[model samples]
Target: MISESTPLAAVEQAMQALLDDVVPLASESVALGEATGRVLAEAVEATMDVPPFDNSAMDGYALHHSDAGHTLPIIGRVAAGDSPLALERGTCARIFTGGALPEGADCVVMQEKACVTDGHATLPGDVPEGDNVRRRGRDVAQGSQLLGAGMRLDAAALGHLAAQGIDKVQVRCKPRVALLSTGDEIIEPGKPLASGQIYNSNRPMLVALLEGFGADVIHIQHVPDNAEDTRRCLREAALAADIVVSTGGVSVGEEDHVKAALEALGELNLWRLAIRPGKPLALGRLPGGDGQLTRFVGLPGNPVSGYVGAWLFLRPLLGAMQGCTAMAELPRLWATSTFGTSTGPRQHYMRVRLDFSREGIQAHAFTDQNSGVLSSCVGADALAVVPPHSQVAQGDLLECLWLKA
Candidate 1:
């Protein structure tokens, strides 16, 4: 339904509109073992203090600070997990690492700092109070917020939860996605190639990217370039998935049936963003059962276009849907440019490899930036954003979006 008179939408404007329409999915409680890479739905509070009690930092002698500069008789021994013991004045308890500090003991003299002879220990004269002792709640306090909502559960975060005796947590459910690849000329790999047919490369690539963004790909189908087939596929996808993403058949060509089919089934909210290699991007919604509407995204057929669009658009969309604060935006850093380029009315996202050195970070752009050159994306570290009508030169600072896994 887009025409020459249809103005191009800025990238930021389109992104904001898409995000505004998202309604996060439901949350569920999952075991800690299964929570890796999931976003927390609620904040976690510490049930008990970390290190529960004051303990020795290492193998040491637990003693009162006043006993400094004196040879104290060894009254008893204590190791980790032993019940608390009372320390008499002028007497010390031989304690090992993580051992609970005894009553009346204010400091621990490490074994290396003491000389033991004939059941007595000689301590340094200047032992300070509370030295080498890990106080209760030093790492985390009881009833304090341990992890905030919308935080992704990484290894360290999971370990922190384990420390708090949390075996399960509430996390946002993964978004269900349906991916469609259009064009009859596209053939699956390992199939005998016809004269005019090319192997389908977008499916596997997009699947990996979608999974990387924490989406559960529920449906994957190749749609032939026909209005009837496109509409049928879109309807089926909408019914089964929360989001339907398609590649190809979005441009204004006669063979492009996806746009017409989308308009027939639902509403086309946006089309034609002002960005190179992905200008013909489409955003729409499709009607679903139970009065629910499924979100839709149409990407260009070029492999590079699909790849770039996945990072620029799909990543943030999924992040917002899952309420993940960290995934809401790509991490950007300014890097010195190692190549020169000029842009037109549309902004360009060039794939580049970053060089981190003592001096600073530098971006090395691939030589071939054409949309059809999928090889340009291999091992790419970041996307260098070149603004419209701007000329960039070597040594100039350019903002780059880091391509994190």
Candidate 2:
């Protein structure tokens, strides 16, 4: 329902509509060693307490608090992983870091605070009870929830699982993506180009983006301007992929036949957006196997346009398909603008380099904001947002989306 003049909010709503139809993939069991970056499909609970037993937190003399300020006999040593011994009421135990505390000991005096002689140790004055003791279950308690569903398993999570003796986990399957590029004037990279022909840059860029986003690229195809051929390719892609992303041939030109082929195969939910650098975007659903619907995203041919469209549409769609609904909207934080801008009817997402100052993060827009100028995106860390029919002066606060996000 959006056109080129629609607001960014309306475009976001249309994008969400397409995502609402996607279903998360089924879960499968994976070894803990291979679970990094995979989405957790089930909540994980700790079977045992971290630091399962009460132990010493440092290398010190373990003794009863009442024995403080007294030169006590060093009856035994309890190093880490060694069996704990019972301490005499007036004696101490030589314990190393992470060592077990003796049963009769109620406190630990750090080695620096205690004077150790040939066979005895002198404790500090008035040492408190429970000093230098790491209590059992102080970290993770038994039966406590460790990780939640839909969370990505990172290095920290993996270490936590290893501490709990977990060897396997259940994770969501990666979505299968079909990538296509169209245009008679476009040729594949690494091949000689004819006169008036340009190499296809959007496909490689999109494929890399999809890989970094963690989706599995199932097929990569290039099609010409033929309508019948486009329709046939669409059907085959929908049958084989959970989502299809294509670049070029979705606009109003006579050679643009992707929209028509999509309309014939299924339903078109969105055809345009109100954002600069990428206004010719198409979103739809195609008939899939087993009565499921395969999502489709058509981005403009220009490299900059395709990049913007990917961030605005394809990323959110992939997130939704993986049950990450919170990623439907990008974070928009305020930043001071180093330069001014005059906007027109459509919303503008200007590439800018971010600099941190005493005031805060500042956005500096590139001199060239043209859609076809892909080089402008280099070294830019964020996209500074400019609303329609608006103007701003230098030092004005503007909202921006971080590129790394």
Q: Considering only N, C-alpha and C atoms within 3 Å, which residue pairs clash in candidate 1?
A: none
Which pairs clash inside model 2? none
Prediction-by-prediction clash tally: 0, 0
lDDT of 1 at 183: 96
Best by TM-score: 1
Q: Write the per-residue lDDT of candidate 2 for residues 1-405, one digit (tens) a residue.
A: 434464343565666766775677888898999887777878899999988887899998999999999999999989999998788898999999888788989889999988878898977788888999998889899999998887777799999999999899988887899999999999997999899999888888898878656688999999888999999889999999999889998888989999999988898888877778787888888998899889988888888999888877777777766665545667777899999898888789999988887979888899998988888877878888898888989999999987685
TM-score of 2: 0.91
| Candidate 1: segments with Cα more than 4 A from true spot | none
Cα lDDT, model 2, residue 160: 92
Q: What local lDDT score does residue 144 receive in model 1, on the 0 to 100 scale?
A: 97
